[model samples]
Target: MKQTYGYQQKARQFFAVLLPIFITQLSLMATGFFNTIMAGHISQQDLAGVAVGVNLFLPFFGSVLGIISGLTPTISQLYGGGRQDKIGFIVKQGFYWAMALAFLFIAVGWLAVPRVLPLLNLEPKVHYITAHYLLAVSFGIVPIFLAGVLRNFIDAHGHTRLTMCITMTSVPVNIALNYVFMYGLFGVPAFGGIGAGIGSAIAFSLNLLLNVWVVTHIEPFKSYRIFHHFPRPQFSEWKKQLGVGIPIGSTMFCEQSIFGAVGLFMTVYGTVVVAAHQAAMNFTTIVYMVPLAVSMTLTILVGYEVGAKRFADAEQYIRLSRVLTMVFVGVLALLLTQFKTEIAALYTSSREVQPILTGFLVYAVFMQVSDSINAPLQGALRGYKDVHVTFLLAVLSFWVIGLPGGWMLANWTAVGPYGYWIGLVAGVLVGAVCLQIRMGQVQRKFSGQEG
Candidate 1:
């Protein structure tokens, strides 16, 4: 009876954290979803331009986001260890990292996009719009990074609901702005795909401002005075964070870049293929928010337990997290598989795009399962600060194995786009298997140390 009660209690706690974060993540993803859908309405070429533009930014943004997320485990550990007072200083350092990354992305966007876009051999119209879209969105890089830092800091203290409120609020704001800017509502000039980028920049700015307000003005966090005294960057602390964050960031860069490469590959097939790929990818990304949320919560929960020196409890949290993730993703996968055609149609009315979208989604269903397993396992590994091996495995699976196989199959085989997706599935499966194995090793190591 006691064990059952404990299980129920743990499940409840997990959901309490997971649900808000889930909503928050969904809201964040909605920015891209709205962009794709709105751009789809403008024209297929516009949709393709937006898709490529977003993919171009994704690898960099995802890497920096992962780097900032290192703060989650750090703050959670501090909270668990009763060292909450030090969180202010750590958070300040994170802001410094955020600023540095923001500038780096801006520089890359300016220098790289010009050189890289033409190399894709995209249609001239599509290429022009993509460049404009990226230019507009680059302005938001700082706000986006800063928002991530604040969200991670707050979430680590178990205040996920605040972040949720902030993000959820942004959805309506983003959607409204997207409609206004994209369609030229209320006498504004229509910017089409570029308008989506503008909307996102405005939305991210609002999100960062709100996060700053809440953290500085709210009761629980205000006492920490995180912004009261800005400390100079401590190289040692920065190095420590970079040690953990760089691997996490690189892992994400590998994973996101693989998909970005796939997008670039699809462009060679034509605009319709790229738009169809966007539809399929956008839908799958929405579904992914669920598992991603649960995985993030696991990081915090496990980090807290590890910091408290409760290795057994931390292991238990991992088990509970995996079970919850499986149940949720299983049901989601089943629904997506069963109704994929109908769902694909929702993204675009273009007949050419719908069939291709549906086809890609069939593969996406299996990818979802592999993704579900891999995401939480990676998060659990992050909690243990066991990141380096996972990074190596990710490179081997996604780059060394996955990308090469995908390129060959895509270029040389009859399977074409499906071949690329098959490569994605293969990569994710390997990553899932390898990550789980590493997690086991980490658990045993911790167990031995505790013993």
Candidate 2:
């Protein structure tokens, strides 16, 4: 009875953290939706160009979110376990890692972004806007890192809603900034796609600045050693972080790459078709973000519970997080399925674009469920420090079933883009199952160790 009661308590604790995180993630993704709508209004080419630009840079972008996210569970576990002194080292190292990564990506993108443009068969007009967008977004990378690390750190200490406030506080500003810049309403020159990128950068900067202010001034956080001195990167810690961080980041990169490759492959059919495809996919991505927030928040909770040696409570919370995530995703799926036509139509004015996207709308709901399940599973595994196997699982599922399967079904067969996305479905299923299996195995092993 005591164990059951304690399990229920932990589950509630998980939701308390998960709900606000979901809201924050939803708001962040809504920013992308706003950008898409704004860009879609400008021109179809502008939207497609944004799609291409994002894929080209996504692996790098995922790396920043990945690296700093490494600190979340580690710091959380330590704090929840009552090891206050060591938290400073983790924060410092994460900050340093963030700055280092920002400089590297900026240099690479600046030198190579122009070179990358012509490589794509883009319209002459899109070439300039895309280049400018790439440059502006790059400047936000470090601030993005700062924002991610801060959010993770805040969540670790059970002050989950603080990060939500920062992100939520920025949404209206982000939307307004987009309108101002994209349409040249504020006496600014009309920059189109580039304007959207600039708005995102400014919003990111604002949120990051706010995070710094609150984390330094706030209770529990103010007392942490990171405020006084950042931790020097120790191999013991870095290796531990790498252990948890690499597979996660790699899984994200792999998953994003698979879907990204799908968009790339669609280019084989033609640009407009691909543009429509991107519209549907982006819409679906925004939906998935809400569940992603749940998954991330659960990771923090699971980490804390595990660190305190409450294995059963940790296990129960994982199950609860998955349940809550599925419910949220299912609700979204129903809403998207009903109004996909309405949503896809908003992205394009053409008759041809609508039909192609219509065929893929049903897949969006499936992708959400698959993604929603897989995300929290990844979080649970990371909380258990079980990431190394995730690398192999992602590769196998993505390359073996998804990439190759997609190629075979789409190219060799006459199934078209639908056939290609079928492979994505298969990939998601495979990833979900494998990740769950791995998580269970790790949990069992961990339970025995705890015993």
Candidate 3:
């Protein structure tokens, strides 16, 4: 009875963390969903342009988010260890790091967008939209990164509902802004596809504002006094975060960039194919938020336990998270397979795009299953601060093994665009196996030390 009660309590705690995180993640992905849907309505070319541009942008943006994510485990561990006073300083340093990265990405966008888009030989309008869209979104990079630092701090403190409310508030605002700029409402002129980027920038800025307000006004958060004083960049502090963060950022880059690379490859098959690929990918990404949230919750819960020297508790959370994640993703994969045609229709009415989109969703089902294992395990490892190995595995799986295999099958075999999707499935499965093995080793090592 005692053990059963303990497990029940743990499960409830897990869902308490998972629920808000899932909603926050779902809300965040909704912005992208609307972006893709609205862009598709304009024209297939517009859809392709935005798709390519997003693919190009995500690797950089995801890296920023991943690097800042270091703060979540770091802060959670601090909180668990009864060292709450230290969080403000770490967050302040994170801001400096985020600012630097934001500017660096902006510079890269300016110098690289023109040179890179032309190489793809995209349609002139598509190229124009893609270039201008990237430029417009560049405006919000700083705010987005800054907000990320704050959100992580808040989430690590177990105030996930606060972040969820903030994000949910931003979605409607983002949709309104997306509509205003994309179709041109009231006094605003239609920016077409470029408007999506503009809306995102404004929305991202709003997110930052909301995060700032929460951290400043909220009770426990307000007590942290993160903004009490801004400090100069501390190299020692930066190095400490970088030790954990760089690998995290790199791992995210590898995973996100693989999709971008796949999207870019789809362009060769023409606009319709590219758009369909994006739609399928977009839906799968929405479903992806579940495991991602589970993974993130694992990071927080496990980090808290590890910091408190509760190794047994951390292992239990790990096991519990994996079981729940696999079951949830399994159900999602079924729904995706069952309603693929309907889901595909959500992106576009064109019969040409619909069939292709459904086909891609089939491959996505497999990827989601693989992610169920790897994603949360990766999160558990992050809790252990065991990031370097995962980074190497990501590279070996996605870039070294996945990309090359996809390219060969794509070009040489009859698989065509489907070949790339297959490669994605293979890569994720490889990463999943390796990550499971790595997590096992870490769990035993920690548990043994505790014993």
Candidate 1 per-residue C-alpha lDDT over 108-211 given as tens digits, one digit per residue, 9 for 90 to 100: 78999999998989999999889998898888889989999998888987788999999889888988897888889999999988888888889889999999
Candidate 1 deviant stretches above 4 angstroms? 1-5, 42-48, 121-126, 185-188, 266-278, 336-359, 407-416, 448-451
Clashing pairs in 2: 89-231
lDDT tens digits, residues 1-451, model 3?
Answer: 0111366888988888889999988887787778888999999988888877887887788887898898888988887777877888999999998898889889988998889888888999999999999999999999999999999998887778888999999989999899899999999999988999999999999999999999999888899888888888998998998788889999998888788778778889999999899888877787788889998998888888777777888888888987898788778878886898898888899999999989998988898888988899999999888999999999988997788888888999998999888888888899899998998898778875551
In candidate 3, stretches whose alpha carbon ends up further than 4 angstroms from where it belongs are 1-5, 42-48, 266-276, 333-359, 408-417, 448-451
TM-score winner between 2 and 3, please give it.
Answer: 3
C-alpha-based local distance difference test score of model 3: 0.87
Q: Please identify model 2 stretches exceeding 4 Å from their true place.
A: 1-4, 40-51, 185-189, 230-236, 270-276, 326-358, 449-451
* lDDT (Cα, tens digit) per residue for candidate 2, span 1-451: 0123565676667667777887877787777667777889989877766656666777768865886787878987887677777777777777776677678878988999877788876898777778878887877888988777787788888787888888888887988887788889857988887887888789879988888888788887787745575545666766666667767777778877777777778888897778778878877776777767776876787778677777877788787877787788777777776887887788788888987887777877787778787878878777766677877887887888888898888877888777777887788788998888888778877775452
How many steric overlaps are in each model, in order? 0, 1, 0
- lDDT of candidate 3 at residue 252, scale 0 to 100: 91
Whole-model lDDT, candidate 2? 0.77
Residue 23 displacement in candidate 1 (angstroms): 1.0
